[model samples]
Target chain A: MHRQFSLQPFSRHYSHSTHPFLDFLDFDGSEPTSAGEPSAAAHIVVRPAERAQLLDVLAAYKDAQNAGTLLTLTFVTVNDYLWLLRAVSQELSQLGRSCLYYLAAAVSDFFLPRQRMSEHKIQSGKGSLHIEMDQVPKILKPLVAEWTREGYIVSFKLETDEALLVPKARQALARYGHQVVIGNDLHRRKFEVVFVSPKASAPRADQGESVPGEHYEESWLRIDLEQHPQKEIEEDIVSELVKRHQAWIAAASAASA
Target chain B: MHRQFSLQPFSRHYSHSTHPFLDFLDFDGSEPTSAGEPSAAAHIVVRPAERAQLLDVLAAYKDAQNAGTLLTLTFVTVNDYLWLLRAVSQELSQLGRSCLYYLAAAVSDFFLPRQRMSEHKIQSGKGSLHIEMDQVPKILKPLVAEWTREGYIVSFKLETDEALLVPKARQALARYGHQVVIGNDLHRRKFEVVFVSPKASAPRADQGESVPGEHYEESWLRIDLEQHPQKEIEEDIVSELVKRHQAWIAAASAASA
Candidate 1:
């Protein structure tokens, strides 16, 4: 069975500046280029190295397609994320495929439900715009318990303060019992992430000695791309994840045999 | 005095899909192109017609810049809109510029105070992320009355519900005593807008005949760009606003003379 896991970026906008793949598209040249109905300056000018890199990428894509590998890309908007997640879970279960859900979208913590929202635009002439939004029901618990069980799951914990990253990540791991929780700081998220897993051994051996089988595991993955800014952290992240998944698959097969 | 007015697009992300002049940069093509460090398949591929359109844009930009015209591009982020507005007001006042403030940004109604936020990431194990944001203090009053008094301020009223557009727009015009308020629905904002002002006559004769001086002055502008989707609504907006401002200037000059 195809690993049945896919990587999807769920955010308000389909294309963003920080997206690893799209980041390459943010060209800095004297001219701009347009594909159809050119409105803006559509001139494409790139340095030699950048052109070579793009050609390499196109070649790789061609190779993958020719090999008959499926590349499924799904775009999720903020308004539809909750409903879409449930639907995806049900679909994956029916197909008997283990899924890996990567939660990376910056969702609104609270929102004005459709029914409570004003029928017309709120008037600014009244002086101040006082909007009281209801807290969105927490979706993680239900997501873990009800959908995509027997599948691996990965979620992100992002905070402005670096000190709170590990503690919060571990807490999420314990609470959700998911496969992995990546903890990162907002400012440094692009460069670093600490993977938290329940199966990992405690960094400090003596700390969890009396806690029965409860041992928090943490693995730090950092990439300094100062010299090579074009290099992405995803390269390392994907490689590490693949290794872990392969090991897990081997162990499962051995047990079954 | 350079008409001393500026149109600011206030949103979390400054450069978006709709800033009229910025629209020229939104090109369409099969492949993406990067100026440097191309990561994904960013090849600049476009048809011959698109190339001609881009050259036209470059020529226009060169002409404007060579003519010694000042085209200020002020980008304001979510956290900085208020401060930037104040700063712009002071700058224009000092220069004795008659400014036109066109406020058309999707601003957040509430925000978490910096002091109240957690030093580190909030732990997820505690269950449920409850964020209590304080209502943003209304700054439009001081903006009009104190900061930019000699300027012509035209604000925008965007509502999701069509019914609330006109009432709210008129209320803002009366309440603030500003020059004008353009009312638009979120979905059709690009193509349709109702300009509400104290000077203009009622749209239809009998609609406001009963009211003594309470006659509503509203002008509906709707452009159907079905065949020419690339055509922007801002072109008309700028032209109309320029006509009104010129008349205002002539009146001011006659009074002094």
Candidate 2:
């Protein structure tokens, strides 16, 4: 079975598991059966703080599913999103090369830790306010190296400057040694995107090889909004990733054999 | 004719006017008709930044009104809210003692001014991010003394510490020389609120008199959720405020005569 995990702060919620293979497979107490076509199942887990709201969301998801449309909703803080990402990646590692991860959420780069946050609202009696926030740990590094070694992980790089898109995407891929980095400019994101990944012969950092700028490949994807106003760029993006993921799975299987 | 102006940073779109008495009354190109019962008209003006979305909201508001419900939506920055408040208050001042300003929105105390804001997104390469924000100007002072001299203004003070409610509310009244300050604790806001105002026969600071701690009166309003789960505390708050506003109007008329 194909498992998907999606996490977003203050909006979407999906589960991250720390269980073994059997426990993961038996999430809904159903045995896996081989079928001609691949089927996907998504699980959503919410924090204990919002348990009451979680129940309401669960009921709503159930109603939507009954009507043939799958839907889930929950809210999370930045800390919760990080925790869930780590936990979910470790659990999905059990699937080995069969997994494909698409990370599209706009996660905040900096956040005030719980200990440093003010208990009461900051009084305006002070003339000015100064705040210091720590950078959120880059979780993709551990996700690629330790959490899910064989999985096809895709991360996004969003930039306001158009010139920085390709370079930033390459930097992310080099830093984290991930499968793909999709770069999009803030204003032009709707119609265009660039996918940056390593060339076939390029060595991965995790494999003890230093990857350079020449070893990376960039592919641009564009859709004409005037030609097809109803079309979404996500369709092209998903199709491209699916093809790459299948090749990855085949390469992993062949190496194992 | 009664005119109401509401301003919120985001989610609520409202208009603030800088027009004269005649221009304010002729907002919709309609002449004012003398009606026995007080009729209220609300105008929503959006900033030029969201002019496109404003049209959509206006259309939505029209649809909702046609269906027997009034609804409006728009988003604004802290700066927009302050500007709208000042402009709207100036226009409403033409109504003299008939105007009542209810300031319930939870405006941020600090904000990064546009001139100091970064042109691009702050990079995470820096270990920690330090941001300094200027204190948002306290607009209530101008709204009371300069914008609307005879208007009955009610401001809100929300505090985490319950003990600070009455004291802070009184301080707001003494500082701004406004008619009322509604104090509510952050946690118990839904069920309880305290109205702090100058007691009858107590001198107001705007009247060249030194108002002391004992001069302010605090009236608490509470609704038990167990007794009436469906009831909202706002209902009681509005009723009390309406009574006080009528008395204020009468007092202003007597002084003018």
Interface CA root-mean-square deviation for model 2: 22.1
TM-score of each: 0.68, 0.74
lDDT of 1: 0.59
Listed per model, the TM-scores of chain A against the true chain A are 0.69, 0.72
Q: Candidate 1, residues A92-146: lDDT per residue as tens digits?
A: 7553323556676656566667897676544442443445556666677677677
lDDT of 2 at A65: 45
Most accurate candidate by DockQ: 2
Query: DockQ for each candidate?
Result: 0.19, 0.21
Docking quality of model 1: it rates as incorrect
Q: What is the lDDT of residue B9 in candidate 2?
A: 24
Q: What share of the true interface contacts does candidate 2 keep?
A: 0.54
Task: State the lDDT at B134 in candidate 2.
Answer: 95
